[model samples]
Target: MSSSNSVEGSYSKRCAACKHLRRRCAEDCVLAPYFPATHPERFECVHKIFGAGNVARMLKAIPVQERAQAADSLSAEAYWRVQDPVYGSTGIVIQTNQEISSTQCELAKIRAQISMYEAQMATEQQPPPPGLPQQQGSLGSQENMPMFEPNDPFNFLN
Candidate 1:
């Protein structure tokens, strides 16, 4: 099991505990039947923990001083932390986020598609969000289209 190639290649296998837990999304991992589809990236499984950056984000959500204090208590305590139910439900896992890595990959693909869509939008003048009626003559129709700011790091085209 301890092979150099294991760390290098696109290994899709996950741990049994994660697989058996049957989670809906990694964010709801605190509860039974966890999944990894909560984040915009949907790469929760790829993270190989819970949600994409959920651990980091959860940790970050707390104040640094509180985290340090909790860390100390955690080390001193012989018992595990109190169990809190995951925000997600068991049905959620069954309905979606079934396969950890595959689901995660699918979620990634969805995000990529969304990003592509957003990028495509960035090329054109802003349009009404989908489902909304387009103005008879919107800015995109104007001839004097302002040049996009390339210097701006968020040019989006980049």
Candidate 2:
């Protein structure tokens, strides 16, 4: 009917949820703003993972102000589910945490090695103990003794 067509034309062509559900999108559809028709796949993925009924129930159960955020979370979860069927986003998070821990351990080892090298260098540059004199020659050698003339006039014993 012309009136029906006009009424339908008055609203958006189709919201993502309506397209995924294969139904007409009403003007006041709650999901229209969050899931526009331009990105139907967003709703499709979410619907496939969390059934349409569950999504509707969840949206209805939460506060109206929080629905958009919830829809975003659902879409992200669905995408992760498709990417990693076994572990999803959780696996990626775990793997990232493990890498961070490993890097931290490696950094600690490098710091300890640097400290050891610094200690070794410091010891090498330090002067020896004060009281230990350097050995130049034997103590009993007469080569360094002062020579005395036997006929010196200044000799008091003569």
Best-performing candidate as measured by lDDT = 2
Off by over 4 Å in 1: 1-98, 126-158
lDDT per residue for candidate 1 within 10-124, as digits (tens), equals: 2223322244433322333332122222321223232333433444454457676575544333222212111213432444454466577688999999999999999998978
Q: What's the true lDDT of residue 112 in model 1?
A: 100
How many clashes (backbone atoms < 3 Å, residues ≥3 apart in a chain or on different chains) does model 2 have? 0
Instruction: Flag regions of model 2 displaced more than 4 Å.
Output: 1-12, 133-158
Q: Which ten residues in a row have the lowest lDDT in candidate 1?
A: 75-84
Q: Against the true structure, what is each candidate's TM-score? A: 0.19, 0.72
TM-score of 2: 0.72
Report each candidate's C-alpha RMSD, comma-separated, in the order given.
26.8, 12.2
Cα lDDT, model 1, residue 20: 41
lDDT of 2 by residue, 1-158 (tens): 99988867854577888877778887677777778889988888888888877887888889999998998998999888888988988988999999999999999999999999999999999998899976667675577776667788776666
